[model samples]
Target chain A: MYTRILVSALFAGACAGLIAGILQLYFVQPVLLHAELYETGALSHFGAVPISAHPELPGFDLMRDGLSLIFTMLIYTGYGLILLALMSLAEDRGAVISGRSGILWGIAGFVAFHLAPGFSLPPEVPGVAAADVTVRQIWWFATVGCAAAAMWLIAFGANWMVWGLAAILLLAPHVIGAPEPEVFAGPVPTEIAALFAARAFGVGLAAWVLLGCFAGYFWQREGVYADATQSA
Target chain B: MTTMTNTRSGLRILPALFALALGGAVIALTGHVQAAALHDAAHDVRHATGFPCH
Candidate 1:
């Protein structure tokens, strides 16, 4: 069972990571590079006037691109392992682990890891300033944990009471509020920053949706689908 | 039957251990193991994807 999960996670993580890495270079990286210009003062937000023309990667920046690919794969593999572990636990409790089910799990994973944390802390451009790292980190993890539990309750609970509990769990961290910086400072203009934020969120949504589709497909393909056999 | 039950218990033990080890590696990489340039490379993606690297 462990071997099946390990291999399946590797397969799903590799494919999804590859796609995500590619997508980032195209969609996310340019915005980042643009932001960096403002960060470094190489270009002003309105300096060139034509926002459509983004800079290209330097001709020999292989090391940078290579590292991006490797990191993307590693991070996605970590996500896949967690996803598979959850499925295994669910199956032990007699829940069916199928592609369809994987889709749901994948969405939950996205919400837990991405959307939940993002609600309080949106993605930032390079030069934007904000809260202390430690406080933000603490709040982020708390949000993910609460959101994950809430999502599970909402998905599997048998009654309205459980749903009510889920709602509270979902909102508890937000109610406490995310830590804020004393002041906001950055070189990037608001318009460019807004564009970056939108693109970043859109890219995240796509990657997470693909993660669900791929995770579900790969997990189910490993014979976890339609099997009454519990391997413990 | 006793042998089958024992094997099943052993199987259960291993995946939990496997999951633990995997989880540990993840924590280490994202936490303590984050060095300078690597963290810088990862930082952008982490922040962009809403992971807490701020």
Candidate 2:
């Protein structure tokens, strides 16, 4: 049984890493590459190769740079491990298939963003100055607001009622207060910072998964092995 | 699921292993999506819970 649990976790961890790596490469990376900060020089210092300049696959404009690699590794190494933990905890075969609970916790992670104080917007493009304090703050708030709504739907439920309510709530503030770009002299590389931050979060999330997997694997294994020996 | 294809010691552990792997992949792919927002949400929840992981 101990071996069983260990094997389970290892298997899960490997799959999580592969799929997460692919998803990041295909979907998330593109969205991030288009961010304002990536266009700016903010992320250039991370490595010699610029992500925006990288050659993308046919029909896929996604660019892979240090920043994208950071995000991919963050998901593959960290978040992938966490999923292993979750699988160990579920125990039952059906639990693995029923991913509703896992998704809720995922949303909970997103909703937590509303609690942040603020963030500074980096320069827009290469050779531009950073965004002004007000612009940064507003951007932070707006982003947080949108995230809050999205997370609420995720954490609570993605049902029509929940989604509808979240949609209304999301649109309310936007109608009254649209986030306008702040007047800044240099290009605001805020998007670059956002990309980095997102990748960092992925790393942290992966850590959480790994920790859970290890704990659950050992905990279950110890109990099962003891029981098996006793029965024998 | 390939884990189940090869049996050792008459134990059907491979299927469970594959299932776990599949689940892990899903979670890894979906878990940290919209993560900045989640970070903020967690920040708020932590404060509300009075744990303060900062």
Q: TM-scores of all models? A: 0.84, 0.30
Top-scoring candidate (DockQ): 1
Give the alpha carbon lDDT tens digit for every residue of A127-155 in model 1.
Answer: 88778877887787788779988988987
Task: State the DockQ, from 0 to 1, for candidate 2.
Answer: 0.04
Worst 10 residues of 1 chain A by lDDT: A52-61
Model 2 misplaced regions, further than 4 Å: A1-14, A31-77, A80-100, A113-232, B1-54
What CAPRI class is candidate 2? incorrect
Tens-place lDDT digits, model 1, residues B4-40: 8678767766785686469547744753244777677
Error of 1 at A208 (Å): 2.3
